[model samples]
Target: MAETQRFHDRVALQLDDDGVAQLRLSRPDKMNAIDAGMFAGLVAAAEALQAMRGLHAVVLHGEGRAFCAGLDMASFGRMSEGGGVANGLNDLLERTHGLANQPQQVAWAWRELQVPVIAAVHGVAFGGGLQIALGADVRYLAADARMSVMEMHWGLVPDMAGIPLMRELLRSDVARELVFSARIVDAEEACRIGLGTRLCADPLAEALALARGVAGRNPDAVRGAKRLLNQAADGDAASLLMAESVEQAKLIGSANQREAVLAVMEKRAARFQD
Candidate 1:
């Protein structure tokens, strides 16, 4: 078990020896909804990952039934319709923090890390919660997982940065229909619609397996590859090609990378520089 009391409010952050840092959404009583405190916890977790060294990968998951049930309706009730409150909300738009990150950016912050971030999603991921899952570079989902573009159902739109991230994952029409209809779909449909990377019986186990595999690789090269991929994912074709070339150039003559090749040939563990 983690040192739970160390965390302030909404989430659990733990780092294990295998270079895998797990960020768990820990509001089991509420299905891990995006409450103000939880948002703060998510941001703190991102910062911790940023400062960590020798970290190979991250696994993001929730503590209970639903990965997240989007925003907590009760929290939204706290804000009054007034100039000061509206201004403060607008300030969040202009500034940046791990917690204040637009719903999408909170998850994207993991992507911005120098290591890989994988999300293990199960249960219900509705509205903003679904968008949070989209923030991960890879998602390992349970076969029966339920997801939704849920904002519409609540008379609101997905303002949590779901639009841009989901754009890459779905067709324009498909994205629109889901958003407009607020349709809830299962993991199988999620995979078909490009919302999932893989569907498994045990998502966390699958995610940890992949994380361990990544941890076993040359950390430097893995970091470089992640950077290049991030650049390519956001850049144009020419830029992507250039990024690939640049990354390969750095990896080719590196000692650790060479050891990787030699280790495989010799069938031994790589004695990396670390």
Candidate 2:
């Protein structure tokens, strides 16, 4: 059996027996905006996911009209007052999750997860919201979705793991343009610029289908593939080749690998154990 957990009423997490996990941003009333509570919820949810057994794939999405509208206005107001916000800003500088602070961990945690993570984005994903989606291995956007690197509009820069994540997905020039102009990009342009992996009529549905397909594969092989792909983003050619060999060596004659081969030969589905 699977259970759903709520974090400060801002994030919801549910795991199915098939090893597919669904993580939803739940603050719909505020367009799922990131506030102090939302930040805490996101980190808590990511930490919980890290310990989940048999986890294979994850789908990240938002409830309500927009995926996320960046930071909450109240938080900005606090910054203007120069009191409450100062403490929060200082806290972001402290390392809480190995190379990332608490806020950065909200996004980087997905990148650190061993299994595949798919982001299903719709409505608008601005600033922090956009950064969160970029952290995922794949992004599925609805045709009508709107996204932007909007920190410039607020006289701020993206600091929540956005820079490193964008480097992995976009060309240097393209990233600079979007970041400089703070322009809103439609789904088609987002796909063309590499911000989105695919565009769909229903992003959540398509993302779930993709996640389920990934979950049905041999878990060890799937994890190895994700690890290799992640390494390819930053590793040298020789190192990547060595990593490929190492991963393949672990998978080639394993029981799950053998089951995969036999199932294909028998024209049946493979029953893989965790």
Among these predicted structures, which one has the highest lDDT? 2
1-274 per-residue lDDT for model 2 (tens digits): 4678999789999998888999999999999999888988998999888898989999999999988888886654444343333226434445667767766778878888999999999999998899889889999999878999986554456766777778778899999999889999999999999999988889999988999999989999998998888787743423332332334334433555455445544568778768
Per residue, candidate 1 scores C-alpha lDDT tens digits across 1-274 of: 3343324478787777887888889999999988667766777777777898768898889987879988775533332111121112323333254332334456557657888889999999998788778878898899768999986553345655566567678999999999888889999999998999989989999999999899999998998998887776654433322332334334432555455445544567778797
Instruction: Give per-residue lDDT, candidate 1, residue 257.
Output: 48
- Give residue 271's error in model 1 in angstroms: 68
Taking all chains together, each candidate's TM-score versus the true structure is: 0.77, 0.82
Q: How does model 2 score by TM-score?
A: 0.82
Candidate 1's TM-score reads: 0.77
Q: How big is the positional error of residue 122 in model 1, measured in Å on the Cα after superposition?
A: 0.9
Worst 10 residues of 2 by lDDT: 237-246
Report the error of model 1 at residue 161, Å.
Answer: 2.2
